[model samples]
Target: MAGPLASLKVLDFSTLLPGPYATMLLADMGAEVLRVEAPDRMDLTRVMPPHDGGVSTAHGYLNRGKSAISLNLKDEGSADRIKALVAEFDVVVEQFRPGVMDRLGIGYEALKAVNPGLIYCSITGYGQTGPYKNRAGHDINYLSLAGVSSHCGRADSGPPPMGIQIADVAGGSHHAVMGILAAVIHRQQSGEGQYVDVSMTDAAFALNAMSGAACLAGGQEQKPESSLLNGGSFYDYYQTSDGRWLSVGSLEPQFSSRLCDTLGLEKMKSFALSQNPEHQVALKKALKDAIATRTLAEWQAVFSETDACVEPVLTIAEAAEHPQLKARDMVILVDRGDGSQQRQIGFPIKFEKTSCRAEWIGKNLGADNKKYF
Candidate 1:
């Protein structure tokens, strides 16, 4: 079936997580994404992790649907070749340090000169211009600078790294995709392409909307896990005797009451209704103690009988084979011609009519050079 972005064509100049993820989003929607890569750098991810056929583990996971093409942007012929493809593509995505593209003569300005209707997006640690624009940093660095890392760990713990590339994925990849889509919409109406500069640090800060609002209102930044929503006694993850976890989200008074009633711990009823700061920890501990008394399945069986919002904390593996996932058709698998089929993080968005669905697996480096060239 033709995806919604079937007519969209993209030239991907990104290598790592952020840029490739953005292109993957579009490609899943049926856009023809042609990833451009230097044979040497070759999306270093391709070299990391679970691999079989001498291909980078990272390559097979993120670039399944993408086609590979090798080229040297430093070569004048490569730059010229890219320009020729620009006129035919609807979008261009690149993740390079500021001025790197301009230095190579393939920046947004140069590309727009070829196709004015092109939707060009640039992803960087900082935007194309700023006091920190030229500074070099990675996801954690950007998160630290943006104050996200400050609030990520436990309040009592020293600085700890936040797992999962939040800055690269949320700040860089996701933001770049949104910007590119918006530009595409604008281009359709105005027939004029524009440059999209996605700044990771700035984007990281944007994620501080809640913390920012709280801080603006004179709230002291607290540790992330301490947040009422994080895993307070009422809405926290409790470890059962079986070493499994039961995620309790009985935050609301009614849900808390229901959970208390289900736990048969009516003595802790008032704790659920307290605004007193001291009660937060006690209430959480009480729930934890109660939950720890049973196995994960026992708790699941208990919570499943109650209206208290609760569920088993399943791993990605468990979630893939979960009844809920099957009911919603969440896990999607595809054969990438590597003997074993490729598995991926599937799409969650669904449109009522044009329901958004993941249409392809990721691609390898420059996975589509011939198709584009």
Candidate 2:
């Protein structure tokens, strides 16, 4: 079956993670995405380490199912070409700083003149109109400015650099996709297009959902290790005897009781239920000591059928090999256009009638230029 977005066409002028990742998701859902890259400039993802089959895995994964066309926006007549393409494309995703695209002559107003129903999305670190709008920043800077790094890590260690690009992916990419789709829906109703300005910092600030609510409405500023779930209570990771770790989140009374019973510490159930700091500390110490006594495999066996929300931590490779993820088809193989297939992460969302699939890995720059130009 054709994917849900089979009718959509996107012109992607973004590089790196945020905008590229957003367009990747759209392409996976069957959107016809044509990437406009520059022949003179190089996107870092194309040469990022860990090459597979002579291509960067990051580029292959991010640009899968998308065609490519090399176009230097600075060149004469480039803006006119893009304007002509925008007349046929449904959306345009870009990651340039404020006023950059305007200087290049293909900004939202210029493109909108060509196609009144164009969905133009701009993803940036700070946003289009702010004090730091033109400031140079990255994922870490955005997270820090958004106050996400303040209460994220251990109190003594400060905020640890995240393994994933939270600000880029969760903040900019996901939100841009949502904004574009919402604008698409609006255009369907009103027959008008709109400009979408996505700021990674703003989205990260919004991600502080529970903590932000507590501070804003309840007059409670959340700090690292000060909240019930953030290492203040027993709901945390426990190191096992085998050097592995297990996560325990038995937050409710019944689950706490079951967890205590499993640990043979039934007397600590009341402490687990208490909101008192001293009681929480005691319960956490008891859980730590008890969990330290068993290997991860041993604890896994004990908690395998238990009702408490306890599970072992697995490495990335282990996670990919996990039965549940395998059953869910989280990993898949995509064609490399040379008879071989490359294993890549699969599209997550499932549908009853429609399907989402990666047609092929990313192609070289200007691989489809002749077809379009």
Tens digit per residue, CA lDDT, model 1, 258-356: 888888878887887776657877887887788888999888777777888888988778888888777876767666565455566666666455544
- Candidate 1 differs from the real structure by a C-alpha RMSD in angstroms, to one decimal, of 2.2
TM-score of each: 0.92, 0.98
Query: Best-fitting candidate, measured by TM-score?
Result: 2
Clashes of each: 20, 0
lDDT of 2 at 367: 98
Cα lDDT computed for each candidate against the true fold? 0.79, 0.94
List model 2 lDDT by residue over 1-373, tens digit each.
8899999999999999999999999999989999999999999999998999999999999999999999999999999999988899999999999999999999999999999999999999999996899999999999998888988888899988999999999999999999999999999999999999999999999999999999999999888898987777888999999999999999988898999999999998899888899998888898889999989999999999998999999998888898999999999999999999999998989977889999999999899999998
In candidate 1, stretches whose alpha carbon ends up further than 4 angstroms from where it belongs are 52-57, 217-220, 223-227, 231-233, 338-340, 355-368
Structure candidate 2, residue pairs in collision: none
